[model samples]
Target: MNSDIRQLEPKQLWNKFADLNAVPRPSKKEERVIAFMKDFGESLNLETMVDEVGNVIIKKPATPGMEDRKTVVMQSHLDMVHQKNADTDFDFDTQGIEMYVDGDWVKAKGTTLGADNGLGVATIMAILESNDIEHPAIEALFTIDEETGMTGAQGLKGGLLEGEILLNLDTEEDDEIGVGCAGGIDVTATRTYNEEDATEIKIGYTIAVKGLQGGHSGMQIHEGLGNANKIMNRLLFDGFENFGLRISEIDGGSLRNAIPRESFATIAVDAVHKEAFELEIKLLADSIKKEYKTMEPDMEVIVTSVDAPAKVMDLGVQEGLTRAIYAACNGVYRMSADIPDLVETSNNIARVIVKDGNIKIGCLTRSSVESSKMDLANMLRATFELTGCEVEFSGSYPGWTPNMDSAILKVMRALYVDLNNEEPHVAACHAGLECGILGTNYPEMDMISFGPNIKGAHSPDERAQISSAQKYWKFVLEILKQIPTK
Candidate 1:
């Protein structure tokens, strides 16, 4: 909170970030942060509007020399992904993200750094307050609940902004300018399995798989990181098949976009075979650890005693569900053959739960090509249906088709070349962006996304590079200065 700390460039942005950190702005709970931004805009005497869905738009006048330049929307999401290390005692709804300077990067104590769009929000605030920079008319567009889903951007009504161009500040890399992105949908499959009371099958123990480094399903899917849910399911399903164990309850994964980090299962086994089952689970864990040594060295599987009577799943239902789930699609399904560095199709086995006489599993499928996305979703849905489970699907959003000859991209490319010695990487992304939705709202507008270097987004290791803040600021200014007046 010191003024001197607030004066450093990225630290200045970090100061605003600190303000954000102090508030409880997790997805669907950003009223406090929205109010703060509204107050900040009012204090600056800038025109501000808070839309029906908590989207905020703060307008600032163009600088002296560029008063006639086209209006531009500097966009970012207001909410942050609430993730924490398994051992961290902090509550995301109350405590501030305890950030620290790690070399040139800024990271949280044991949780997500919220730099995905926090950096975007801070940079916009800094640009608004800078008295030395010259630029075009600006509309700071902050949307809510981007982490949970695209609800905020999807909820944005038409005719909310006067901007002719939109600049999305949510990309991760420092050198890449993302012009297009994949569209995705959340698919859930539920199987209602009857659980009957059974005689006290000698109580064994529950197995828990945790401490895995889960990351953004879209951004880090290609990294071959271990998914705790998948691994736990494999261990349980295979172990049960071989050890004759029965499951009492099974649950795994969290956010639809995050690769699951922790999973737990309570099983009922014959008391005599308990020792052998525990050893088998341990051996399975060791085998997987050795298999994915470079990717998931910190993986752990532990079995602990639970005091409970046997209420295991019916044999038929358990076998059907296990087979359906294990056979379900997960991780990166295909890498882009044409784009060299792009993930063309992918899916995340996002969430699984067993409760209230039913079992539900959710998977998110994404692709730059619409057909491929639907194909994968259908494949998974058919697999579930084949096993007698009910399936539900959501209407998918359209992908942003990349235009190599796009006018805004040309302007941005030229600006980057002018500011930096090298040209920016112009390409598409595997993750979703607001451009596809915004384009539908403003058919005449030109849009592109770029951002400072951010790493480990949607995970506890998330961080933003301190040095890239200045470079981002400089490039944004250059782009604004070069935009021709209508």
Candidate 2:
């Protein structure tokens, strides 16, 4: 299947993408990919260097007649979000993505397709290795761990590159040219609780929430897609209220940047009310399914008898935990008052874990405005703190401020109109891009972002549009040919 992808139109781009996806490159653990990129750069005999934080840079001198143009920084992150279905057996750390062509898209088997930034990385790779494509002097900046953190971009120092213009290939919509993006922070709530011995009269059942179309938390937050952690919390909350249900263990979600797709819990309820509990819960599950039928057609909530655990969570903490999760905001908190249809702020209840004597809830909050970002972060902090959890905010990065007057923006806008007789959607997005962090040091650089059409990013349903990739590749070549003169 990967070979098929390499054979697609614009073979150079798709082939590089296939090569990149073959490497196991999870966020915060990119040692293998780093070395792979280093070898690639060295093979071309270009001026290559790795930054202190492991960002890979490969410099390519401009071809004939383009040397006088401003040096362009072609940037994309090397890391990808790692997520899989509960039933999938593949190991992300050891196994390369198994991808296939489905109709007009390229999809992975029960895991993330890595198209979010992988396609971007591959685009840079193709351009760097090209012998005939005319372009200005190029500095290929492959930052690491953009998914887990922007540490790679944050650690990048000033004056490392001579480029005056930066082209970020990390946007999702092919018709949209991203001029700005939201910043994000990791808001986590953690605490420990006492574990009580399971009562003799309690009977155990497994509560599983599965089959939700999980996606990139930031990009898809406005789509009203279901979050598995939130759904599990809803069931547990109702169960406790009606049947004295207690939790023995819960492990839900995978990453902070990807919306949770499935959750499984071990719970016990009083045997005396077991019949009523099952009946009522089934009714509730039906309601949940009906509510999400349009958005989550395959969503399922199942309950089945299971061997009981020796211990369960303390009742007091369980109550507070469920309440806090229910009250905490998840989804579009506010839309940009200025940008039409642009999500200004949002949150995803990305992860939740409860077992033995501990509980942890992880969330990713994003906003284009810094004050609003912290406002929502503080709101979550207060909600969790009231329930006896210690809340902390970490990995905070600033948003990219849009420059409608950018020189490259003018050129790209005109190019789009000329090529397709249609104007591109030039706007900002809710998803975090490395442009803002990179701009922190390279404050004077002109930056713009555009990419191929990718759907269901950060989840197993993630796929890249085959036709859109062909369109995007042509656009990339045109943009390179039209680089502004120095």
Question: Pick by lDDT: which candidate is best?
Answer: 2
Residue-by-residue lDDT tens digits, candidate 1, 1-486:
223335557555767877766777899899899998999888889999899988999999998988878898899998988888778898988777777776777788889988888888987887777787788999999998877777788888889888888889989887999988888888888878888664575675778888788888887888898887788788878767887777778888888888898888887777777778778878888888898889888888888888754577887878887888889878887777767789988999988887646888888888888889988999999988988889998746767877777777898888788788798899899888878877887877778899999888888988888788778877877887877786
- Report the lDDT tens digits of candidate 2 across residue range 248-351: 99999889998899999999998899899999999999999999999999999999998777899988999999999999999999999999999999999998
| Global Cα lDDT for candidate 2 | 0.94
Quote the RMSD, in angstroms, for model 1.
1.9
Candidate 2 C-alpha RMSD relative to the actual structure: 0.8
RMSD of each: 1.9, 0.8
Error of 2 at 390 (Å): 0.7
Q: What is the lDDT of residue 10 in candidate 2?
A: 90
Q: Which ten residues in a row have the lowest lDDT in candidate 1?
A: 1-10
Candidate 1 ranges beyond 4 A from true positions: 1-8
lDDT of 2 at 472: 93
Q: Score each candidate by Cα lDDT.
A: 0.83, 0.94
**Please, what is the TM-score per model?**
0.95, 0.99
Q: List candidate 2 segments past 4 Å from native.
A: none
List, in order, the clash count of every candidate structure.
0, 0
Worst 10 residues of 2 by lDDT: 306-315
